[model samples]
Target: MKAQLIEGGSFQDSRGSISFVNDFCFKDIVRFYILENSEENKIRAWQGHKLDCKNFYCLVGSFRVSYVKIDNWDKPSKALKVESVILRASKSQILSIPAGYANAIESLEANSKLISFSTLPLDEVKDDDVRYNKDMWLLQ
Candidate 1:
């Protein structure tokens, strides 16, 4: 699995400053997800889609987007490489993850949020999602 970062930035005007970001291109965006992690509610990990590659962007605050390649599913102890990206609203970066990869999200701030852009629709994503334990890939 490979991860690509999309460039993003902010701008200002006479009235007030504004921010904007673009991926250059995102084809067939079928779904959007807004993930929030807070003290009352915590998330170690979530579902990983088999049919869709997701693009992650931190709308506010900061968090860690972790991913692992699932090419070798038979051998759980095969020592697959785990990759991570720190997403922050200040930096305004978008991370694109391809299919066949498992993802885990960790919130670094109190009220952190992540917006996910999916290639597949909700129905397909539900059927194709492969749920993995956070303990397996998440750092203790």
Candidate 2:
């Protein structure tokens, strides 16, 4: 069980965007997740995994990624909205995420595909991936 954390700064080499790759301890049983951002899951809570690590690559357009520390499980931490950046795959930039932090990407374009990969395969409702109400986290 190996845990890793890779941020956009290290992976994204684009002048205005970001991307990266990460290889964890998992030799097999990796899970691939394709997320299409819509109005429903616009605002939410994401917690880092215990055993799984992630890699994010921008197939098109750009996004604004943010993170927060988990002081209270119910309360949303500070809103650390990163600078809005563009990730053009033509430049070959990718974002890699390790297992320690929570992250969310808001699409800058109307229709964009942010390809993300993870090593641990599990359901979204599992203990590894936890999401809370954005508004709910603030009050806690």
Candidate 3:
């Protein structure tokens, strides 16, 4: 499956505002984690799961999420296409990345925080986790 952006919206009332992604379903999510970068342009690169999927949401500031479909688990091709999307807290949306892909994320603003929802439980992650060099596939 390919990457998809599940768009969401916000509602502002006299008291405050509410942001939501009404179409997002948590049925398959087994775990979740938050990613915060200390500085802008800092990247967390090239981590993948062969059997697990991931969903990302920006909680604070903005981010650039880059991903690539893996051609081979052992050694992916250097020419693999890289796709990216920018997520901002102002825009309530979720970036869904399906299994069999590698992804990297970069903070576009200082102290940006991103939440990641995973389909695999912590105990089963080790077996499915895969990592590659940061420079393996250049981001466009």
Q: TM-score for each prediction?
A: 0.87, 0.58, 0.97
lDDT tens per residue, model 1, 1-140? 57788888888789887666665467778889898976865655645666798898898899888887786554454367888888898887888988878788888888888898888988776677777766776542
Give stretches of model 3 more than 4 Å off. Answer: none
Give the local distance difference test score of model 2.
Answer: 0.52
The best candidate by TM-score is 3
What C-alpha RMSD separates each model from the true structure? 2.1, 7.0, 1.1
lDDT of each: 0.77, 0.52, 0.94
- Rank list by lDDT: 3, 1, 2
Please give the lDDT score at residue 107 for candidate 2.
Answer: 68
Q: Which lDDT value does model 2 have at 37?
A: 77
For residues 14-70, write the lDDT of model 3, one tens digit per residue: 999999999999999999999997664489899988999999999999999999999
The global Cα lDDT (0 to 1) of model 1 is: 0.77
lDDT of 1 at 109: 89
